[model samples]
Target chain A: MSAAPILAAFRQAFAEAWAGGAGALLPLGFLGGTAVLVPLGIGSDTDTLSAVGPGIIWVSLALSSLVTLERIFQADVEDGTLDLWLQTGAPMAGIAAAKTLAHWLAAGLPLALASPLLALMFQAQASLELLVHLGLYALGGLAFFFWGGVGAALSATVRRGGLLISIIALPLYVPTAIFGALAMTGGIGSDGAPMLLAASTLFACAVAPYAMAAALRLAAD
Target chain B: MFAGQGEQAKPLPVTLLTAPLLTARDLAILRGERVLFRGVGLSLSPGEGIVLRGANGAGKTTLLRMLAGLTRPEAGDVARAAPHHWIGHKEGIKPQESPRGHLALWAQAWGSKANIPEILEKMALKRAADVPGRYLSAGQRRRTAFGRLLLEERPVWLLDEPYTALDASGKAMLDAVISSHLRSNGAIIASMHDIAGFPVTAEVTL
Candidate 1:
């Protein structure tokens, strides 16, 4: 298959993420804000902070990714890009996958890159463990974005569907969040949790594109 | 009409080459949980134009969407020889995108290598090519949307209310383009309140 259409879609989506400025950086700021506020909400004790730091980072990462999901496909639908996509006769799944991947690159990746700083703030060791968690955060962030993309496509036609997207996507995020938190905290039964975290992301990679494609088709109809 | 080709060697074979580009049989559609129209059928051949005329709320847009494969008909089927250019009410123009940038994106997605500068000139949009979509007026945006038609040589064109916001000169320009497109063996199925100064093969009124 020719990759021109998919690549063009990717460029269009990625450009929009930065063109508006708010779209590209709001999630990063949100992630950083949550990382800062969590310590104040509870106590900043080193033991307490270390006990829940990684888990808190994972939760905020997932939530921050959702901040951008509601507009991912909804803007395309509103601006008639979806109809043009249908006319081009390219695989809708490919277009959906490209746009979602662009979203992950724009909104999710920054949060992952900042995870080391967030981890530092939460008293995570400034050592090799931080790098391991950084990698894990990237993978887990991708899973969250893909699953959230399905919800975004499903609600593309609904007005103010941000809440609806969160409702639909949060339940699907359970596996990744649990596995990623366990992998980070090194708690009991966490030996295979890192692999399981990667597996959850792989499963999302396998399934979310087609699900988004079907939902987008319905939205276009 | 066949005799106007001025080919005496093999007129019969030349005539046989013009097969129907689009065909629909007994198409039915609904709007807002109500049956809008049913039993609609039309055939479009090379160089033919089908104009859909009806009052407001007559399902013209729905029928066009069904033919473009954007919406499914409640009944019957549509067969198309190739992909079509569908221009709906929404111009697909992003507020932050310039006319040139919008066309460039479409060209890349449609895999059309047509010259954008030439299309910009043909559409009288050279001056406004670099202006952002939000800065463009309605007529300018409509003209930008029409630029997509020239970016690719598709066999069929399905336009919904294409003349909605065009001025007199813009309408004349569109008429000229429609005539040229018909002369080049391209079929057009458009919904409009009236067909002004353009040759039409048939009219379907609901």
Candidate 2:
């Protein structure tokens, strides 16, 4: 079977995910700000909000992952592109990874670009905070995309979406959401987050490709 | 009619001197609810054309998907002759990407390309080379995909309904192309709903 054809599928899938996600930054920005408004708008009764308000950026970023994932494989899945992709003689894992990368480029980059805006809106940054926030956001967002790929692939098969995706994906998000929040805290370095997140991210990343690919196989089957 | 010189020499592309293009045996798969196919065996010699036919859910497409290496069967040893083509209903063209760009990616992956223009002309897609796939009609898309086959010098073709959206002329064009491929002693395993024009000596149903 042809290998180039599969790579072609990968490149196209990546480009679509990136372009689609970046195209919708306005709403994502609003959502990010609202995440800030909750505690800041009400009061400081919440220690965790005052203490970990900064982490909301990752939450926003995580949701940004949800932002574009809904459409990840929908177009092609409907138009017969996914089946054609399977026709090409390449491992499904590679195809899944290429798409995940595309989602990050589209959704992750936008959140990073909007970091200063989010920081300023929340009054969360002091000095070099955007830099720290951006770094951690980049790492955490990438990890989130891996898991999202798995969700998107599985959800691609379902009839009713959104709710199911959130249900399936939300539980997984707690680990990432908590780990990401802890990682962004005031600290000298990555601490537990770097290793734990990297390891957790590793597991997510490692399993995502095969899992999504397998899901595609089942859906096609 | 368009198949190269090989079609004139023999009815089947198989030869004792050459290796069989593909071989598979004892292939099995298990899904969440039921078994898709079990103990599946397959082999195709050079220039051999095996048509997989069954009802919609009978696993024709699934079998092709597995042999194309999309999903490894749950239990089976599947092998292929180098330079095979598995064309499904996808047409595999990106709506945003132009025809040449789409074919260029295939050329890069399949290790075949004489000249883009010559190939497009052969497949009658030279005029649509610059257009994105979305703008093209269903026939044009299938033509462009078949153009990928022409540009790629592979010997084995695994096609699923190579006849989906083609006009009568387009169907004739496809039949001639496969005929020519066989002429060159290359094998084709096609899963088609309609197969009146081409020669199909074997059938595998799941």
Candidate 3:
């Protein structure tokens, strides 16, 4: 099919991400809150802070990724965009992927980019290694948002589905969380942790859209 | 004047109406374990219009959705020669989106190059074109919803309660458009309370 439908969905989603006032920056605020609280709650010991900093970032990222997902498909369903999409004859999976990816760029990407700074706030080093960790955060964040999108689509028709979305998505997030933390802490047999993390993200990217499409179809019914 | 096309769209004689563009036979639907309707049937040819009349609990919307291919019948089947334009009760306009922006987005999505300004003018939304949906009156939003009809040409139109929220002038505008579409060999199936001057060719009471 021509790229027009997908482009329209993407552009609309991208614009909606920023149109909600300060709502778009909510993830950043969430990450910033976690960054501030970690130092206060866990004490300011340098060794302990640096050791657990990466894991904290991943956990916070996973939690905050669910923030915007509840509204992703729910809004479309309410506003009747979902019905129009059903009639458009474009691949629903592609539209689902485009919408989720747009939301990721709006809400999830900033959380990933802010992780390095958040790591610094947790007392991690300013070495070149920080850049590598930044890359990992971006990939991990994408995986989280995509998986969360499945939950969002599934619960799109339910009223006040935020908590239900978290309940459904948290279990799916386990693999990415484990591998992401392991990749940072140099755990496991070899240098396979980062590869496993990348694989998890890739797998989510490939499969989440189809799952979302099926759920959205059911929601439309 | 809206029904007349210059030089082209040669008006076919009434007897030359083409084969049915949409047909449904023995259609049955259930809502919440209650049998809403069954053995329902409909057929539409070019330049034909069907009006569905029923009480509040009747299955008018369900039948419309079934014909539009949005809902599957429990026992029967629907055959469509082409896609349909479905305008449900929701109107589909986002609260933050203006009518102009909404139409522009739909034009791109449907890959239609219809003139946006002309469509807005036709819908009587020229004055409120750029105002956000939340600020528009119910009638204005319904008119914006009707704008999709002009965005692209579809063989069959499946409209549910299309006249709800339309003012007298808006209703008159709709009548003119519907007559124009019928003159061009387009078909329409609308679930409505009152015909309200629509040139309905057939009526189905659920």
Off by over 4 Å in 1: B1-16
lDDT of 2 by residue, B6-58 (tens): 22333434454277768888888766678978988988876677888888877
Clashing pairs in 2: A4-B109, B3-B180, B3-B181, B6-B183, B6-B184, B7-B183, B21-B81, B28-B75, B47-B186, B47-B187
lDDT by residue for model 1 (B67-136), tens:
9898988899999864578889988887778899999998887667779999999999999999998799
Q: Candidate 1 chain A: minimum summed lDDT over ten consecutive residues — where?
A: A15-24
| Alpha-carbon shift of residue B174 in model 1 (angstroms) | 1.2
| Selected candidate, larger TM-score, 1 vs 2 | 1
Model 3 clash pairs are none
Q: Which portions of model 2 show Cα errors greater than 4 Å?
A: A1-10, A18-52, A74-76, A83-91, A187-195, B1-19, B23-43, B52-59, B66-79, B111-114, B193-195, B202-206
In order of appearance, the predictions have TM-scores of 0.95, 0.79, 0.95
Candidate 3: residue B191 lDDT (0-100)? 91
Residue-level lDDT for B169 in candidate 2: 81
Worst 10-residue lDDT window for candidate 2 chain B reads B1-10
Task: At residue B47, give the lDDT of candidate 3.
Answer: 86
Docking class of 2: acceptable
Q: How many steric clashes does model 1 contain?
A: 0
> Per-residue lDDT for A58 in model 2?
70
